[model samples]
Target: MTTTHATGTREEWLVARLKLLAVEKEFTRRGDELVQQRQALPWVRIDKAYRFDTEQGSVSLADLFRGRSQLLVYHFMFGPDYKAGCPSCSSIADGFDGIAVHLANHDVTLTAVSRAPLEKLLAYRQRMGWTFPWASSAGSDFNFDFNISFTEAQQRDGEVEYNYLRGRHAMDATPAPEPVVQFAANCGTDAQTYARDRPGMSAFVLEDGAVYHTYSTYARGVDGIWGMYQWLDRAPKGRNETGVWWKRHDEYARG
Candidate 1:
């Protein structure tokens, strides 16, 4: 049950606080509604044989999940053509990598997938100083089937966003998803690179060592886990908007 305010101010101070309680209850109700909507999303099966390159060696979709019943794979935005990944995506993945071990204990194996070749993925991972499992899906239709790869025509139809050279929203990029595609609709693109409509996060359930795609998400659907600012925003040096930077505690360690 929600708490209520008292009728007293400074002279009757308790009453004002009581009113604030009512407002809190309304907020709780709205929050519950939002959660319900999120849980209502439908699931899909991944019949394609998506292969990835890992540090240990090459692996198939089923092999990646180990023995866990649930697998959550993040489709990182590092394409084979690009030397570097999207900065925003890099920022989000930074946190994801660190949390992998913790999540594994709970029967949820989390990993990152990208279209970059094995060497490229390893190079970037080293440069970014990440330890989470990363795999390459290059030379596979996995990206296209998942709606993240762009076709030349889709780029012309305003379906992809690229971040190559000087990023700009243009129709010049090659291989983009058509407007009819529900995944990449209204996606902003940068001319230097063509945006694929397949950018997304996917969840899977493994029973008897076989994996079944249970849920997947893209765009804002991943907003919850990608940013550290949300938690920091509640702190004293809080941010009121995006673009605020955070300094690591270790970086500020003083001898």
Candidate 2:
């Protein structure tokens, strides 16, 4: 598709650009306000002794901070039954590993958690060339507690809360969307198993030798962390699209 716009004089273009700049500045101010509010939110103390299987061996939730004051957990959607992580989550993660080092240097640790067992997570992480820490919550209630992984019975019942809301799911339909089916196939699983897991991110802070859940965001709330989308939002076309047009970075190489 082609888009045509009216040609404008240099003065006219400058005037239009100045108008847009004002709006952009206001938006940045509001974004800063939201960040302050998020930081002011109360931190809930975490008491459950959740365990994770990491390359460094079994570790607890507090251990994830790795001597840092803060921890950021990306709930990567790789369920126990899937052969790989979700493609969409993989796309988000493509922009994360590079920033993890910067965060680590700033007294924060960033890592990904999934239910796909340590072995599978390691294999896929190797394929993706991701250097950041990733761990498996397999055989633990971590993902279930965080509402990122669901059970078979829950799938049949078709009511699982995500992002703090409960709604009818694709599992309730006779046929789910083609993309859901395709994503399942790509992960070597069916739609039901694939949909059983959702993507999320959580923040934690260590204080007084105790771990506290500072905040969490799921679904669209996680979008701001996607560096590519942040760039696309500034592009001329601005995320112009009619359908899914991305794949795992490694998948592009194979193609």
Candidate 3:
């Protein structure tokens, strides 16, 4: 009877482990599908010149890559309109300092691009104590093309429809529609939710010294960084059904 009980417990544990593996595999498979979809997204042609001020001085779009054939620009949400650097963007910037060295080993340069003037950007970087390369795109249309910077009309409208999918039907015979809203410039709410409007890190491949825009993402964008919190708390309270208690950095300081 003792041997039989031990065997039963071992089997139960194995079953539980197998269940967890199944869930993990399912999640991985879904993630792979989404990545493949993003890889297939059409690349927009970038023709207009983008001039940005860097620590090294003013440089054109191609110069920002710093001699590397491929450039990855993180369109950070620190604009002149923003009172302070976005909390979510600040979290990502926190990780970037450590990542810079590793990415350099792979022949890629990672830099945070924002619309904030050079002085403001530098001051904020000093305030945060970040050592990563943060550049100002205030003089260029770089942020505008990336969908992060808003114009006067864009801020007034509060949103922009990319494809005009106003009326559509889902698999069922019911009117279904999804509106991609851009409200960051209009309202300061949902800083995390601006993924629907903001363009993600864009990669440019150089062929014979010519730069070409390769890839960009917006939806489920900052998952790599933001999703890390889910693992720390088994019972995440909000968002994705997880009960993890997460608060902005500023919120925790009040106590």
Candidate 4:
């Protein structure tokens, strides 16, 4: 078949591949350094009592660790008004169940936290057939404090800060993007309600009977862990995305 992409002899391809390998190795080394820097960030002691509702019942933030010394919380975007979890977050979470056990064995508890009620979260988890832990922060300041959830007042005043930036998300635009509207409708809510919640992750450590927030990342800062994206990035087409082209795993048409 004819192609627009560059074509080359085996020898030429090998030359390019070797050069790319060198760059990839450098990138890998840089990523390692960044990981160390991330771990070096100062941790803020968590004093305010934050609670979450889980299958086990209402539990303190510290309890979410499940006896682990480190806690990793994925701030899922399932708002109280949504009929189901956000499809994008659901896609990201499709990889969690496989990794949660490995994380637990490594002294880390991996869980998802959302603003949706516990019942809603549990029902959705059942539908997805996920075994990883999920906790609801409904009526709690956990999401807001992490800057992944915004208040109506904050939205009204254009004070929504995300990914360490203020008033910059495409969702905050006057005419919401078509993908945002589509995702919101898919979740059974309007764009504004859907945008009220955002996606991110946070890390915490339990030390000397106190929990400390170590790091939190929002927006694309989370791309590194979105499993599907990592694989797509290595594929021949390399994402090749024109627009929103994903759905909850089950929503895809089966052959």
Clash counts per candidate, in order, are: 25, 0, 7, 0
Q: Each candidate: RMSD to true structure? A: 8.9, 1.9, 7.5, 0.8
lDDT of 4: 0.93
In model 1, which regions exceed 4 Å deviation? 1-43, 159-194, 197-199, 232-255
What ranking emerges by TM-score with the best candidate at the front? 4, 2, 3, 1
Off by over 4 Å in 3: 1-13, 29-45, 158-199, 227-251
Tell me the whole-model lDDT of each prediction, alpha carbons only. Answer: 0.65, 0.88, 0.63, 0.93
For model 1, residues 1-255, the per-residue Cα lDDT tens digits are 654633344755667657978988998999899778855765465677777788878788887786777888888877666656655566678787668888899998998888878898788778778888888888777766666566656555665443322232433334423431211221133433535433468788777555666666766677767676567655755655543233322233588
Arrange candidates by lDDT, highest first: which order?
A: 4, 2, 1, 3
Best candidate, lDDT: 4
Q: Which model is ahead, 1 or 3, in terms of TM-score? A: 3
Greater-TM-score candidate between 2 and 3: 2
Poorly placed runs, candidate 4 (over 4 Å): none
Clashing pairs in 4: none
lDDT of 2 at 14: 97
Q: What is the Cα-based lDDT of residue 191 in candidate 2?
A: 90
1-255 in candidate 2: lDDT tens per residue? 554966688999999999999999999999999999999999899899999999999999999999999999999999988998899999999988789889999999999999998999999999999888999999999888888888878767767877887765654354878888888899999997888898889999999989999899997899899878889998988999777777988777654
Please state the error at residue 62 of candidate 1 in Å.
0.7
